[model samples]
Structures are given as C-alpha cells and as structure tokens.
Target: MKKLLQTIILLFFFSLTSTVSFAQGYKIIGKAIGFADSTKLYLADVTDGSFKPIDSTYIVAGDFRFEGKLKHKVVQTYIHTKNFADRVSLWLENTTVHFSAEKGKFKQALIEGSQTQNLWTELNKAIKSSKDEKEQYVQFIKKNPDSIISAYLLSLFSTSWGNKTIRDLYGNLTPENKTTSYGKNIETYLALSKDIQIGGSFVDISQPDTSGIIRKLSDLKGKVILLDFWGSWCGPCREANPKLVTIYNEFKSKGFEIFGVGAETSKKQWVTALKKDGLQWVNVSDMKGDKNEAALMYNVGQYPTNFLIDKDGVIIARDISIENLRTKLKDML
Candidate 1:
C-alpha cells in the first residue's frame, strides 16, 4: 500500500506544444523509444528507502505522459520502465518538461524545461566524468553554494560521507540553501547523532503504548534490552518479527526484554501490525511518522535499526541480528 494517493486533478494551464490542453501542476511529455506498446512507465518516490509510485502511464505508440502537481515546488523522482529498467533520476519542478530517450540510455536523455533538472544534468555529467567522485561533489558544492541542489546532494550522501565531511561541506552552503528541507534534516541528524552511540548509555524514550499509556525506556533498567526502531510499513521489519518472537520467548524469562519503538505515520496501522504480528513485547510510538520523537532521538535514518543494551543501560551492540542477540544472551545469562 503506497502512502500517496493518485488523484487526477484537472486544472487549467496553457501548453505551447499542444493545443487546447489542461494541466495545473506538472506535465511530463515523454517519448520512449525501444519499448514495446503497453510498457508501463512509472514516476516513483524512493526518498525514504521505499518504492512508492505516485503516478504511472502505459506506452501508447511510443508516447507516454505523466501529469501531477507536487506539494512542494521541487521534488525528486525516478522515471523508469517495467522492472526499473531505463531508470533515470530527475529533479522535478512545477513546470512543463520534455523527456526523450532511447531504451537503455535514459541517463543520457535530453531533459529540459526545469532549472533544477538542468542543474542535475550538469552535476551528473561532472560526477560521471570525474576520477574521484567525492572530490567532484565537493567542488560542485563549493561552486554552487547558493543552489538548493548543493544542499540536497550533501544530504543525499550524508551517511556515506560521514559527519565531519558533511559538516564541512554544509558549512560552505549559504544560509538560504541551508534552510531547505534536506539541509534542516541534515542539521537535525547531526545534532541527534551526537547524543547516541555505542558505549554510551541509552537515551530515554517516552511514547504511548497500545493502551495509550506512556512508557519510558529508562523504566526497563536492570534488564538486558533490545531497543528496536522499526515501522509497520517496512517489509524487512515484519519478516524479522517472528524470529524476534522466538528470541524473546527463549530469554524473556531471564530478565531479557525488547523495547519496540515504531517510526510510524499512522496509529491505526501501528496497532494493527502489533496485533497481527502477535508482538507481546512492549511496543510504543509517538505517531509522528518520520518526525517520530524516539526515532529522531536515536538518529534513525532507516527502518529496522536496533541497539542492544547491557544490564547497566550501556549500549553494547549497535545493530545485532536476532541470532547474534540470542547467542549473546546465552553467554550473558
């Protein structure tokens, strides 16, 4: 189930390429070559490490069209065919754009009409031709300090680039650029990451459980704990629940406990998953979705992140698998 709903909003707009046409938000007139008729073309958002299709169309006589208005002025999307072939990442704006590319060479396709797309094209070209990709990225940021693209690029690789380098690059961006959504998230992540790490005592997390009673992580002191950061929408988290149940049943009687913190967007879905998965352990959420307080306190960037705490509340393991948790529990208890 995708988070975004598909709504055909018919508004008024003037198209220079066509006569008597109507579109309010965004319009992408695409000409796809080397694809058979009825091939599906999808515009998907993979920002949160999940594949969600916002709009899609079928190839009719080598032509395809996708029209939708983004809530924001600028957003990122991946245009692809069936099985994600000919995938091309493009930054879209609320403007008309044309995409003309061959079957597998979508990356080299001619995309115009949006200034953000133009910048993306230039940046991609430079990155592809450079010997050291990181250096090229750094140079790009330095050159375009005021560009929103720079901030987004920095945030995109914040995890892989490490905190120091990301901070240095971010320091070079202008105040206006730093105020973008991506830049603000990076700032928040960096600040929160400092408070949580291995060998450090676990931070206290408070959220309402299924019964609407608030529970605190500090209350689980003196017991071996696994602080799991997960969501009901995450596939891997659901699949790992059964194994986690087995692990819990084994060592639960030996002062072992699992503190499940859900980074959920909806309370109904969270409660449903808890019941369906038979999660007997204490599960809690603030129901703030990506803005979840517990998730941000732990600086969780992806789903299914966990930390194993010792009896003294010191973080002993950063992300231990269920099997490893069992093994460690057997040795400890």
Candidate 2:
C-alpha cells in the first residue's frame, strides 16, 4: 500500500510539472486516431503567415502533446494526420476548451468552458433562423448589434445586399452601446466603405502605362478615361464590352481612352477572357472575387460596375448603364 501511494505521488508531480511548462502561449493535448494509418501531431505557431515548429509526438499510443508561444495574440491550432484527414482548433487567451475532431473536420465538443462560447452560441442561433435571409439578417443585427456575433455577421454581409440594410439596422442601435467593441467594429467597417458621391473625384494614384513599364494614373491627367469594371464570366459585361470598344475606337483620337478593372478569381481565366473577348485596353485587378479589396474600396456591390472619371480623374457617374454611359461619353469627349 505504501509503495502504491508513493507511485501515485510521483505521477502527480510529473503531470503538474508538464502542465506548467507547456501552458505558456497555447497548449493542445489530445489523441488523434487514424483509420487507415498512423496519426501524427504537429505544433504550429500561427504567425508570419506560416506555422512555426514547436513540439510533435506520434499518436501510436493514442496520445499527443503540443506546446508553444504564439507570436500573435490570436492563433489557430491545426492537426494534420496522414490519410486520416486534417483538424483545426482555435485558442484564445483566458479560456479553457475541450473538444474532439470527427473525420478530421468538424469539431465535436463534449466539454468546453470559455467566454467565447457565448459568441458561438449566438452565431449558431443566428444561423439557425429560418426567416428570409435578408430580413432575418436585418433582424439579427437589430437585436444584437452590441454582441460580437452580430458584429461578425454584419461584417460578412456588409458588401452584399445587406450593405444598406445592415447600415440602417446599426443606425437604429441604442446610442449607449454604439461605442462598444461590436459597435466600433461595425462603425469602422462602414466608415471605410467606398464613397460613390459625385464631386471631389477619385484620382488614380497608381503609375501610368507609358514606356512599356510602370506608369502612374496621374500621367493621364488631361485625357478622359472610361474606367470599366468587368469579368469574363459576366454575360452582361461581354455584351457591354463591344459598345465600349466602339466608344474607344470613336474617341481614341478625341482624347478618350478605356481602362478595365477585371473581377476574376483565377488569373488564367482573366487572361483567357481578355484575349477571347477582344479587349484591347489597359486592365488591372487584384485577381480576387467580387469581394476583392479594390472592389470594396470602390463600393461595387454588383458586376459591370464602373466609374466615369473626367480627364482630371474625377468620378462623374457610378453604375452608369450602357445608354447613359454612351451619353456620358459623348458629353465628356
């Protein structure tokens, strides 16, 4: 009996020491099971846009331990096992969580104790609602604008049809809670939204296209430029491209030019579409989807969006239809 008691004491001391040493940044202690092969453990520090190696152990015994300091305040924990699948877990400060992964994908939480659970619960409820997407979304924001869940949802739908609706919902928020973290995040997001109002025109700070090299947008100061936003997948844009082609051909000698901003996710698609569509104009894009950074800056919610900038690089019209665009071009040229 005395020997058994001594062994238990020793085991307790060892476990205590291990916990203290590994609990610095974030610690993931769990077992991974592989159906077809052995499982592997990986400890990555979610910083530098890459994961940093810390400690790794095999799951042959169905046990693993990972420990490391996160360079950033927020970091993600990933478990990549061979032939089994991959699992991802998120850890934040001042929280304790216990969960398991199923098929290396969805997390099955059998136990958890954290403040973030509230945010999760709220998001789950918001997503479960069966009302119309737009109206349900508007109602969610109206009720929980002061909660992180609402803030995140609002940010997600800000640039969609929810853009205007979400804005109006926030306006109805109580003034007291408007300065909360959720409120401020929404405010900052809305403030950064692109302004499409006429006058105080937008200038092209980018370099010009002369010398077959880098050029600034300011170089085309005296020429009226038709800034066309288009994509290869857009049938409307394709139909509009010919009209633009006609306009460019007619006005090229009259101090008018065409510049295209493509909204294509794939580089190959953008290039192929450009060639196939016979677009002989200067084009640029970040190669992101409709929610691209540039598109967000320009407040473009729909495709075939554009800005008719005067020679001085001032926005004269936005979302100008083909007929209106033709009339605007005639007046500008």
Candidate 3:
C-alpha cells in the first residue's frame, strides 16, 4: 500500500506539469463551414510590416487547429487559406481561442476567447462610431495600461502625436507592458521621432537617384532646402508638383533649392512623371515606394510632405502650404 501511494503521487505531479506546459502557449481551434477537405491553412507571423509563415496544417472535415508558442506574449498573426488568397488577421495571446469562417470568406471570420481579443473587438467598435479615433485610442490606453493591445495601438499613433504626448502615454503603461515587443517598438519610435521634430536639426539621408548618382541631404547644406517627399502615384503630390515648379524657378537664384525625394516603387514611373511635370530640380529616390528609406526616416505619414530647412540645416517648417512657403521664402530672402 505504501509503494502504491508513492506511485500515484508521482503520476499526479507529472500530469500537473504536463498541463501547465500545455497552457503556456496558444491553442487556436478553427472551423470552416464550407471548406473543402485537404485544404491548407497557414499561420503567418507579422512583424515590422512583413508577414512570414510560421506553421501550416491541412483541414480535416472542415476543422483545423494550431498550437504553438510565441516569442512575445502578444503578437499580430494572420491565418491564410485558399492558396493564400483568403486571409484573416488577429491578435494572439497565451490563451485558447476559437475561430470560425465560411469558404472563400476567411476575412469575415468570427474570433472568440481571450480578454485582449474582447478588448480589441470593443476598440474596433468604438473606432467605427467615434469621430476622433486617435482620442479613443488614447482613452483605451489610459483605461488598460497593462494590456499589450494598448501598446500596439500606441505604436500606430506614434507618428501622428507629438513627442510629449507619446512620452506621456508611454508613462501610463504598466511596467510589464513596457517590456513587450510593441512597447519596445514605441520606445524606439519615440527616440527616432525626437530627432526629426520641428525646430530640430534635419536628419541626413543618402539615396541613389534615377541616374544612379548618390545624392545626400547634406550636399545642399549651403542653400535653404525644400526637402519634398512625394510620389508619382499620389494624386495630391502630382497636383502640387506644378506649383512647386513655379516656386523653384522663383527661388533658385536666391540660395534656395528643392531636393525632391520620390517615394516611388517603379523607377520608370518616377522618371516619366518628372519629365511630364517639367520639374527641374534635384530629384532622388531609392525607389522602394512608401517604404523608401528617406520617407521612413522623416516619418512621413502623408504625401506632399515638405520640410523647409534653413541654410544652416535646421528644420524651420513642415508641410507648409504653397502660400506659406512663398511668404516664408520672401521673408527669409
């Protein structure tokens, strides 16, 4: 009887350990109502605007499941099916979640489970009804500082808000949240943003132009520079180019120069637009489109973003109107 009791105790402890280990990761159970048999389902991990497939499974009787651990406790993940044609994006946490969808309609899937998911649902609903979505995000962070979802939302708004506003919001986050992946991203973003803020010294950028010649922002330091971030495909940028051409002609001899940075993916399109618009300026681009190195460095959230830099290389104004640019140039010249 003594030996049997010892054996039972050991088994009980082993079972408890197994259960705890399984609970440490995420468990996602999914059901697709009209999915075909042997269909492939892929789980993709998203980071820094890129998606990578991490796991895959085949559907059996319209049911599928994924079980794995995440490096970060909370992360953005996507589920793709139908040969990667259909996709559903969701936030994953260390908890079991249930997802359901219909054939060829994965994006409209229903997701359930986890407190963070519930909060995300509520936040989306609020965003749909609120006129000021940024304020709603701020309010949500204020209410749930410990939530990783709040950290993600904060990161999204980092480019729009001022340094002090972002820093204050970061301060409101819990100590644990401050160490999460998105939390660290926010910290890094704020650090970079401080350098490019209005009144701060301009950050230098170097990229190959259409002629394959390297152009550096510092090369035009002796002149008052209009660092224009624009693209051929951007309607507003195209519309504003003619006015900029006029401004450039007027100011070219007054120690003022326009350094146009095209946020274009296609080099052919960029060159064509430049010729068509009759823009005679120092235009340069790395040709990575919106992900252009200069655009990212400047934190340009919109096209036609212009930074008026003084001859001394200090940023004097940002996104100024055509009239404002003219007035400022007249006053300075």
Candidate 4:
C-alpha cells in the first residue's frame, strides 16, 4: 500500500509540473472594443513571406486571449480576423503581451510587451520627427546587437545605407542573432551587394523573354552591355525609353547592346508597353514584379536603374545620365 501511494504521489507531481511548464509559454491577452461577440480571431506565425496559423479563438464579450509556445526566442506573428485584410503584427517572445484595439481601428491598436517591442515603439516615434532617422536607427542597431529589434531595424534601413556601412552594422550582431531569418537575409544581401558593386564583374542572369523563351545575359558577353532594370508601369522608366532608344540607334553597330529586364507582374501589360514604347532592344522578364529574381539578384530597388558593363563583363558605371552615358560610349567605343 505504501509503494502504491508513493507511485501515485510521483504521478501527481509530474502532471502539475507539466501543466505549469505549458502555461509558461507566451500569452497574448487582447481586448477589442466594439468587437462583436463570437468574432473569430486568428494567430498566425509569419516566416519567409508566408503565414501559418498557430492558434485561434473567438471574442466572448470584447475580450479574447491566446497562449502558446514558440521554438525560437522571437518570431514574427500576426493577429487578425478571418479575412486577414486588417491585422496587427508583432514579435512574439516568451512573455505576456497585452493588446487593446477598437473594432475599426486595428492600426491604432496598443501593443505592450517585451523589451524588443518597447524599443520598436520608441524607434517608430523617433523616425517620424527625427531629421536624421537613419543615424538614429544605426545607433539603435549598434546598441542592441543581441536584440531581434536590431535585425528588424537593419532590414528597414538596409537600402538607405551603403554596402560597407551595412556590412559593418551587420557584423556587430551576436552569433545567435545572426542565425535569425532577418540576419540570414542580411548576410545574403551583403554578399550579393559586394559582387555587383561598381568595378565588380556583372552577375549573369537568365530570365524568360516576352514569348517565354529563356535568355542568358552571358550570351552578349563580347559586347558593351547596358543592363537595365525597369517596369512597364514605372513612369520614369517609360519616359527614359526614348533617350535609351536614341542611344541604341547611335551605338547599335558599334558592338553595344541593352539587356532590358522588365520587373512586371502582368505579361499582357508588359508586352503592350514594349510595343508602345518602341524599345527595340533585347527585353526579358520573369513577370514576378518587385519579387523578380533578376531585380533581387542585382539589388535594384529604384526604377530606371542601369549598369554599364564593359565588353569583358565588368561594371564600369551605374545610374549614369544619358549625356554621361553617351560620352562614356564615345570614349570607349
């Protein structure tokens, strides 16, 4: 009887311990004013531009709650209604997060939680009024190298700073921080940025032309290449096509070629613009718009960007004016 009693006691203790451990995971206690009773709310884990539902609950009165655990120290999570048209996003950490919002004022929702969220809030306020917000973010990243907020800030200001500055800031992150999604993205961007900078060899790209025929940039290696990243919907790109056409006419017989990569979403619109603009150059696109592989590979953020590559495939200049490009061509060819 004594042995059976001891075994029962151990089992009870183990059950209690497990329950406590499970309860210690991250918890979000939310209250939405004017929200209808039984309104469905969803919690989604965001990674690699995709959403995976984690847990869900419905508002009983104006209150709802979610409690769960995450494997990582921090993960980007979103909370929204069933349609997901309106949502709130925050970093979910092992802490109690308090959220409050009005029915139609989701953007104005109040999120109070971990140190990282606090820092993010502070930075957002500073960004609105600060004249030198870039420097403010740089300092924050420097001071919070171990924090996930640093990685988030790095992503926001990555394109604003030069490659060397980005590299220096990224190098300050902790080993654990370097393993996060944003950190890995920074590493990849830095490597690609360095390889495509002025004086570096042009990175070869293969994309589909308008008719779905694949074309390789390397096929035009023996000619002076103007690698243009543009879109049919871009006003500046459309305006600049006439100038490019003139340049092409002047240099076509002199071993000069323009490889125009269109960052377009719709194939029909892209084809229409190509014919309308009379861009008689080699045009190609993967029809992925902003997420185009060629655009991402070259780190082309702004529209109407061009890189002038020599016959040997080395980038000579980037984003030069038409007159400057004409002068350079006269000098080279």
Clashes of each: 0, 5, 0, 0
Model 2, global lDDT: 0.61
Residue pairs clashing, model 3: none
TM-score of every candidate: 0.74, 0.51, 0.69, 0.67
Candidate 3, residues 1-333, lDDT tens digits: the string is 999999999999999999997669898999988877988889888755567887898889989999988777678888997467788888887789999998778877889986777788889899999999888889999999999888877776666675678789999999999887678877876665545877888999888888999989899998999999999998999999999889989989998999999988778999999999998888999876665667656877678899999988999999999999999999888
What TM-score would you give candidate 2 relative to the actual structure? Answer: 0.51
User: In model 4, where do residues sit more than 4 Å from their true spots?
Assistant: 1-23, 82-85, 195-201, 206-214, 221-297, 302-333
Clashes of 3: 0
Tell me the lDDT of candidate 3: 0.85
| TM-score leaderboard ranking | 1, 3, 4, 2
Give me the runs in candidate 2 sitting further than 4 Å from their true place. 1-135, 142-152, 160-192, 205-216
> What digit string (tens of lDDT, one per residue) describes model 1 on residues 221-289?
999999999999999999999999989998999999999999887788999999999889989988777
Q: Score residue 44 of candidate 2 by CA lDDT.
A: 54
Q: Candidate 3 — which residues are off by over 4 angstroms?
A: 1-15, 18-24, 33-39, 58-61, 81-85, 103-107, 195-216, 230-299, 310-317, 320-333
Q: Once model 3 is optimally superposed onto the true structure by TM-score, how far is the C-alpha of residue 280 displaced, in angstroms?
A: 9.8
Error of 2 at 139 (Å): 3.9
Expressed as tens digits, the lDDT of each residue in 89-171 for candidate 4 is 87788789999998877877899986677777788888887899787888889988998888866654555465678789999
Expressed as tens digits, the lDDT of each residue in 86-108 for candidate 2 is: 64534433344454554544354
Model 1 residue 159 CA deviation (Å) reads 5.1
